[model samples]
Target chain A: MSSKITWPVPDPAAPPEAHPALVSAALSAARAYGEARAEHTRGELAESSRTGADGTATMRVDELVEGAIADTARRHRVNLLSEEVGFVDNASALTMVVDPVDGSNNAASGVPLSCFAGVMVEDGVPTEALTCWLDTGRCWHAIVGEDTAYRTSGRTELDGAALGLLRPHPEIGRSWWHLAERAERVRVLGTTCLEAALVAEGSFDAFVDPGNDAHRIVDLAAALVMVPAAGGVVRDVFDRPLEIDTDLTRRWSGVVAATPELAERIIETVRG
Target chain B: MSSKITWPVPDPAAPPEAHPALVSAALSAARAYGEARAEHTRGELAESSRTGADGTATMRVDELVEGAIADTARRHRVNLLSEEVGFVDNASALTMVVDPVDGSNNAASGVPLSCFAGVMVEDGVPTEALTCWLDTGRCWHAIVGEDTAYRTSGRTELDGAALGLLRPHPEIGRSWWHLAERAERVRVLGTTCLEAALVAEGSFDAFVDPGNDAHRIVDLAAALVMVPAAGGVVRDVFDRPLEIDTDLTRRWSGVVAATPELAERIIETVRG
Candidate 1:
């Protein structure tokens, strides 16, 4: 099965340790889940009557995808840590951090800016990551040791930089807007994984969260691997390393940027 | 030519005076231009060496699209009011308010949330409007007397409504976040026409601007027609009517909502 999985190596120097078959299984599961759900209307899919394993309101689509992904992971003998089903312990050493659907509101509302992401972690470190955009069916992935498929824009200034921001809670809205006002363009696309990918691919110079524990481990898992692999910086708001335990309840306020300088500038702007 | 263009009657009551052929020609032009530009990368398309007709930095893709739109308007014998080329007088009663490439920054940076919008105004009142999502090629249109193709979500409360917000400047950032904090979700997709269309189609409950002169005639022209046709309310922040002159220099702070109740709630939230 490991031999059957083909991973593209953009950087020949860095090959990942997690078996490619595990990543392939996750991607195939996500694609299958997304395709099935795409046929339904937002109205049919958006009912939040049930609570997820993570304690947030769960939609029908969430349960559907989570079930499909968990089935795939079990078949591949990989452990799963996901939003809807919490952590499913398996026999293998590798754990897949997954968000069956990120930006549920956007997906439920037909906003076309949601995605499915899964990151393979081995021995407490993420080895490989994959993000599949649900609307466009475009997928981006990176292994920590491989050459990144994309590069950051190398933009160091905020004056005219394209920035992506997540929606802020009332307590942090002011702080969020302070940083937003300094940038030439600010977009809040309502999806963290896709927004982080935009920064990694240079579509956006940065993707910042106004200081609140708004993002969970599942949300930032793929970004933690993809951003650094693409020559971008992913850090917490306080300049702390953006590592968290595999606990589903743990949350982080993240800032993913094209460069370290831009990341520091964002930190200063929000703190100041 | 006018006889050849058949406008679909979503509303049997609305018999627009503007010829359907004019609207068809404009839509075709936008589609053609978008398809041509979609082949290039964001890096290749995002050069800002030349200034646009509106005194903002212009990209080569913008010029290409704007020229194509202008030529189409000229061929159709419609007067033009646009962001790129300003006003072009023609020997026709119908003036097409156009944003050749709305969300230019999004397009240039490959954000996939940009559009082309054209509204046919006779005697300063918008009669027919068309908005084409550039990335997806999905188009929404409405004539004043016709039945609307979509409806708003009719959510009156901000607590859990899907809100679309424009990025606010420093002067208005506080006011913007004040309203943003109350909403269940806030999205800043960076294109006025498409955002407004989302509101009109029930995908978003409301689309608001933080109190500043952020939007121009070209931005709101299509919304002014589409929102009302879809049974939504559009008004300025001051509770004034959202009517603007044909002058490209003029600007307004606007809000489009699924209901008058929601619009009033947003206005009160911002002002308070």
Candidate 2:
């Protein structure tokens, strides 16, 4: 007996500098999220994963948003590699890698902190990225090897620096406490893509997954391009190389930080 | 070389069903916050507590918003009790208690999760309350003993419930881990009032302070009236009576839940 989250989703204010395909994809994702909110209650959206009458899995909000992005890819005539759909071939060297809804649980649960994260990869190299805050319609765009409109906090230490983290993994609870104790401030925003955007924009000094190994390629693709463009660095806690891959099964503990020194510090602490 | 958080603060969408004073105060807070964002950079706003050349503490984003709220109280001719500015007497029986900006750090940091929370009290009884998420302009309003438009999730167990929490305090970190481990999902959104509103509306199963005793009267003031109207209960972990009080020095560990049984379960788990 609950109502749906009724907040209106505004249009994406994508920067004029962003790629046309990325901008179009973000708009499509926003529309799909809005439509879902309008038609379904929070409970209904949360229950979209049940078996259908035909014994097939029902589409959740994530799949619905991904479907919209797929339509955008079709119009743009680019290949798509997304979390839910895996890969859709378009006979093009350029691929649009995306996490249609970054925090699918948050999106379905009516939390306003989800994101649309996409990167344009040319023959396995990410050339540009766009990440949009779906609720507020704010967008951040970045191209490889180019200066961005924003910069990181440039913080080099963990003490007195604001930190963002994924929720603790029960198996690694000590490491969670270790980093939380060292940081002067900590936030767990429940969305890795949005938290990474905050780090790129200097709102947060760093965002990390403390030994969780919970992020897929779709989760870190956009941050890999955007954070470095803004003078920050995105790394895996285990020192694994981050690249655009079509393997949806790969996972990493992504760390998006204001500076390389701080990223190393976080990795070391979590590992210790 | 970081930029200010440039997101616009929309006008509060205060429900027509609320007391005029609460709505007016929320509007004033939003306006003041917007003005501060337009006029100052994030680093400058973050350093607002410095002693000025005139030997006075500088006006912070928090103070600016509170000043505007005070002006609204003046216009309404009601007594005001707030966090930053302790209390203002208007020779009237009615008082407006507010946390001018609930997530002050989140506000100045441009995290887009801060809120304006206000409660209208008559002779120390909170008769009505209003909460506005400053980022999205969505609002929740409720009068004591009146049914609200939304209802809680009615979750009776913590095993699979989604939970929101305040950041961890080092001294009491075990309690934080205890609750986080038991919950099926956890989020630390860094804003108590907004998180409480999520619990009230069934977006989150519960929001708790985890024995930190970090909640001031202004933080939980709006939740006391709003959640109960929406079929939830807001309580203190230590079982302290919550009421309208002018003493800003007092604190409580707040537990806001969808049902009475769930509230008790959380309190017992945290206390253990």
Candidate topping TM-score? 2
Tens digit of per-residue lDDT, candidate 1, span A225-259? 89988788888886555664655666778888999
Residue B227 error for model 2, in Å?
Answer: 0.2
Clashing pairs in 2: none
TM per model? 0.84, 0.95
Q: What is the DockQ of each candidate?
A: 0.30, 0.64
> Which ranges in model 2 have alpha carbons more than 4 Å from their true place?
A48-59, B48-59
Clashes of 2: 0
Expressed as tens digits, the lDDT of each residue in A1-272 for candidate 2 is: 65788778888899888888899999999999999899888767766555422223445787778889999999999999988778899988889999888877788888888999999999999999999999889888899999987899899998788899898888778888888999888888889999999999899999999988888888899899999998999999999998777777788999999999999999999889
DockQ of 2: 0.64
Clashing residue pairs in candidate 1 are A11-A147, A14-A145, B11-B147, B14-B145, B14-B146
Off by over 4 Å in 1: A1-44, A122-124, A158-160, A239-241, B1-59, B122-125, B239-244
